[model samples]
Target chain A: MKWADIKEKLRWCAYLASEAYNMPYRSTVARARREQDDLFMLLIFSEMMGIPNPATYYTLELQPIMLERFHDWHTRMGMEHSPLDGFRCC
Target chain B: MHRLFDRRIIFVGGKGGVGKTTIAGALALMAADGGRTTLLVSTDPAHSLGDVFDMPIGNEETPLGPNLSGLEIDPEAEAERHIATVKMSMKSLVAPKMYGAIDRQIELARHSPGTMEAALLERMADLMVDARSRFDLLIFDTAPSGHTIRLLSLPELMAAWIDGMMSYRDRSRRLGEVLKVFSRDQSKEDGFGMIGGSQDEPDDSRDGRIKEILMTRRRKFHRARELLTDASTTAFLLVLNAERLPILESKKTLDLLSKFNVPVAGMIVNRLLPPDAGGDFLRERRLQEDEYREEIDQTFAGLRRIYLHLLPHDVHGVETLREIGEAMAEQLGGAFGAAKAP
Candidate 1:
């Protein structure tokens, strides 16, 4: 799948995880994306798990570069797509 | 004498990798040599007191100088001790069959917010209370600024929570007494002991005594806070390098301490590259050092700035610590008032 599609899916997963965990939706989505390394893998994993917050172990292992890429993807997606796009997954 | 070194608690904290422990060691040496019974304690989870002193520093106090003692609190050991105390307390109160479940809960609570650092602080306060006469000064080689703030503030937060719990216990006792009187049974007296833990029950008295001891600990916390805030009794020294990160972090720390009403006594600029003797690299380092020295002076006005030359070897063992003590004294214009040639 394309990186953009993967990031979109990851965003959706983050939204779902935040809702499930009763965390602030936007904050959890930010935290989830901030924690991912490869935008493509983050998207793929989010799509597969259908939940966002990444597991605790994954969060702990996250690197700065991964977080940077995830942030770039998130920013690009935010500009092009509706902010409400991920809400349906929740 | 300005009584500069008579401080009860000397906190050495700044960004990591800035020689905080080394400076703390030197200060402890000076305090000890000056005849104050000083205890140098490290609250940092990443223990370096052993490495700094070149001696084993366990939970127990170890004498370093004529009147100086050192302690490096092992967080894991402290956490285990905390868990054991909690488990024992729970076992004394609850049913025997439920002790196992309560122990698990206590273990979980051990990792709860602020428990590890708080336990360390409590242990430190307990040490001070027990050794009040033995030691006149407690020098804390605190962790980096953030962790140190949390550790220092733990006492105030814990004290407030304990006070609230004590009030709740009082209310519960009153309710229990009322319910027992209405029931008109001898078992009602047992109910009185349930909440208040009456004189009749030895086990209850043990728990009650623990609570009383904890309440009594409020004075120690108050004393510690006073020692921290009063300029006469405490001196919080910030140890920093000329590097950008440490300098910026020190600035923020100074601001935070001011916000908390903790008086910052001075700043120690450690590991400064000496002015050029020969090499181009040394000359360039000296230039950077001059620039940062200017910045530090400008930023932290009216505060005494002490600069120590970079040493060839790592600061370890009492010999090196003594050398550092000499350097520190000269920089601060204390006992050993003049800098000696290397």
Candidate 2:
């Protein structure tokens, strides 16, 4: 999946989690989700920005697992109606 | 002053991002102003004592005001110290070949569940006994409420474990001594003495000194629990703004604390809209403030309530702290004054 697609899905997942917890979708939730996505993107951006990935680097192999966990968590929490649900590429 | 104050340890704890440090610091100042020598120590791993006081408070105690000092205890440093103590004790008994394995075990012991709280409790117990003569009051600016409870409960949990270990240690010591005597090797005498130096060794002269210290810690825990429940000695002044999210979180925290039998002493409604006559924006803000203030009062009923006007800038430095302190003192009714004698 492309980075943009992953970002969109994660944002939806974040909103779903917040809604499940009965938290308001205010600036705090937006900021928290944005921060989490920013962290996720920073690592990939670092690698693309000429940072060396040694033999132990396995970022490519972990993307599917991370997405699966996010999907599993949302599904288990009964948050299947999120707008970005059908956007998963994997 | 109540006799409970003499043997009490006060721990101020709440959720993170709540103004626990500020309230703890202000209470210490109030106690000092009331002529009690108070030591406010932070047991939070992520400390904000320096930020709260706007002064450098390293590992060692730094004087904040007359009769008031603050210390920030670093849990990592404490864990290291505990690991070393355990390694030294284990080295005296286990075979030389097993020393490396034993050392690794001691290192891994730091990662065990509740080890952080246990080590912190041991350090606190030591400090309480060591400073028994220096300070009259010990105020802990504890971590969030969950962590604080875990830390406070460490003494009882550790005492139970110590009881079981003491019997095993005593048997091992006797067996080592007997083996040494049969071998007739005086060189092993000193080695066998090491195993006998467990913490349970009863001293005839001091009688129950160690037991007294443990008992004092247990009493301190009970006293802290009481003060938290009692509205007089301790007051949980929650600092919350007039926002829905923070208000909800504060109310939830109050509910949890009440459920756990920890009293909500009072609520400090911070950053409220001023009563200034202004445009529509100000009017809307004022309406929101009124709504939230009513919500706070209704949610946390049966406790004293105070409102603090929103300040333009962040509260920092001694000067700002003093100004905020004065404002808070006024709202809460003049610092050390009796709580309306109701």
Candidate 3:
């Protein structure tokens, strides 16, 4: 093999090695991110989910932007039906 | 030393039917007559500014007199406009099929109780930031005491909420960046992938747009809260009748405004019985008023107070409001100390 080919192979080995070493940290981060995202979705859609959010007016503008993602969010959270009355994402 | 005429922003608020609109209009007239450009805005949904000015004053600024302008805010209309604007903004983020569902969602939110107040407060905040540059005095004839208090308190509440949301976004971004885990795997692996963004489009702008919106709103709310709480620049003129309920309500309002650091410039005691009317019924009513006035003096001690007598004439048109304005001249103008309310 050419010298450049050997160097490229070595670089790939190092890259994969680093990724493997950081696997535990990556999983923990992924879990943390999932939890954070769940909390955030809850904060924004708590009113829709039947939680009385006193600050609903302040969050109303964010609803349209979050609508498309609502489908994915509810389904991922195992909601059989859309929690909001008259709003069917399915 | 808060002078009524010296403040740039004034909110005239009180219990319903306490002549807050008339008082606010009178103050605006005085400011205009003093050569200060004035805008009289009514945030009360049951608007009588048009009746007070005897002219059609809508949402936009309409010239009432020389250097005086009027605008009446309709909370329901504002709420509709707000929803429409949000819908327009989300057009690119939503699919054509999802429009009906999204419209229904926003429509439900529009009918919510706090929605009207929120709309009114947002318009008030917008006026505060936008009109401060053009007008020397911005007089807000707010709704009744309870409604106005909620509107005033919302600026700080909204600012804190936006701040919390932005900080959360920042922390989440930092977590990904610091861990060097910012990858493109979410679109492929996660169930909660982005909504309508194209695959070729970078993931940064969606959250960036939310951050931008949050930042803009935060600045407006922060500026509004700053202006409202700044005792030197803004003053809340409390108007109330010399009756029992209004007096008690005014005391509660005073406490609430003080707690929020919103300075109460003075009190205008409306509809006091005149002494010259000599009848047994009049005498008894005046006696009751005298007692309430005493309570007012005790409750609102150290605050400059203006006492206005019951006028048989309707407080309409420039001539009537001018009469009320002149009555306020002595105590409020500070230039004319001996004059009294008619």
Best by DockQ, which number?
3
Chain B TM per candidate, please? 0.82, 0.69, 0.90
TM-score of 1: 0.67
Model 3 lDDT tens row, B1-342: 125667889999999999999999988988899899999999989899999889999988999989999999888888889888877876667667877777777777777668888888889999988898999989999899998998899988888878888777777666555344433343444343322213223336656766777888899899999999998889998999999999999989988998889988778899888779888999999899888888887887777778888797788788988898887775555633332444
Pull out the clashing pairs in model 1.
A13-A52, A37-A66
Rank candidates by DockQ, best first: 3, 1, 2
What tens digits encode model 1's per-residue C-alpha lDDT throughout B204-317?
A: 443365346546655667766665577877778899988888889988888878876788877888898765466988888778878887788778766767778888888879
* Candidate 1 displacement at residue B26 in angstroms: 1.3
Task: Kindly list the per-residue Cα lDDT of model 2 for residues A1-90, writing each as its tens digit.
Answer: 999999988976764564444323223433343344334333322332344432101122222223323344345336564213222312
What lDDT score is found at residue B55 in candidate 1? Answer: 82
Best by TM-score: 3
Q: Worst ten-residue run, lDDT, model 3 chain A?
A: A30-39
Q: Is candidate 1 or candidate 2 better by TM-score?
A: 1
Q: Which stretches of candidate 3 lie over 4 Å from their true place?
A: A1-17, B179-202, B332-342
Cα lDDT of model 2 by residue, B153-265, tens digit: 45445445334333433443444344333333323333323222221223222223323433554565444444445544443445566677777776666666666565445
Better of 1 and 3 by DockQ: 3
Docking class of 2: incorrect
